[model samples]
Target: MQLEKDSKLELNDRSRQIGDVITDVESKVRKKYETHFQEQEDKIAELQRQLNLVSARSRRPKRGRKGKEV
Candidate 1:
C-alpha cells in the first residue's frame, strides 16, 4: 500500500512539471506573435502615408475660361 502511494505522488509531480513548461512556452509564443503583428501594422501605416503624399503632389490645377462679350 505504501509503494502504491509513493508511485502516485511521483506521477503527480511529473504532471505538474509538464504543465508548467507548457504554460511558459505558450506565453513566449503569444509575445512573439504580438510583436510581429505590431511591426506589420507600422509598415502598413508608413506606406499609406507615402501614398497620400504622392497623390497630393500629382493633382492638376483647373484654369478659368474667359467670359464672352455680350
Candidate 2:
C-alpha cells in the first residue's frame, strides 16, 4: 500500500510539472502572436494614411482645368 501511495505521488508531481510547462509555452506563444498582430496593425495604419494622402491630392482640381469653361 505504501509503494502504491508513493507511485501516485510521483505521478501527480510529474503531471503538475507538465502542466506548468504547457502553461508557460502557451504564454510565450500568445505574447509572440500579439506582437505579430500589432506589427500588422501598424503597417495597415501606415498604408491607410498614405492612401488618404493620395486620395486628397486626387480630389483637387488642377490649375489648368480652371480656365476652361465647363
Candidate 3:
C-alpha cells in the first residue's frame, strides 16, 4: 500500500511539471505571434504613408482648351 501511494505521488508530480511546461510554451508562442503581427502592421502603415505621398505628388492642376490654367 505504501509503495502504491508513493507511485501515485510521483505521477502527480510529473503531471504537474508537464502542465507547467505546456503553459510556459504557450505563453512564449503567443508573445512571438504578437510581435510578428505588430511588425507586419507597422510595415503596412509605412507603405500606406508612402503611397499617399506619391499619389499626392502626382496630382496636377487642370488646364483650359487653350492650355491656360482653368
Top-lDDT candidate index: 3
Lowest lDDT sum, 10 consecutive residues, model 2, at 1-10
Clashes of each: 0, 0, 0
Candidate 1 per-residue lDDT over residues 1-70, each given as its tens digit = 0123345567777677678778888999999999999999999999999999988876744445665432
lDDT for predicted candidate 1 compared with the true structure: 0.76
Candidates 1 and 2 compared: the better one by TM-score is 2
Q: Indicate which candidate wins on TM-score.
A: 2
lDDT of 3: 0.80
RMSD vs true structure, all candidates: 9.4, 7.5, 7.7
Whole-model lDDT, candidate 2?
0.79
In candidate 3, stretches whose alpha carbon ends up further than 4 angstroms from where it belongs are 1-9, 62-70
Candidate 3 local lDDT, residue 49:
100
lDDT per residue for candidate 3 within 1-70, as digits (tens), equals: 0123345567777677678778888999999999999999999999999999988877866679999977
How far is 41's C-alpha from truth in model 1 (Å)? 0.4
| Decoy 3 TM-score against native | 0.70
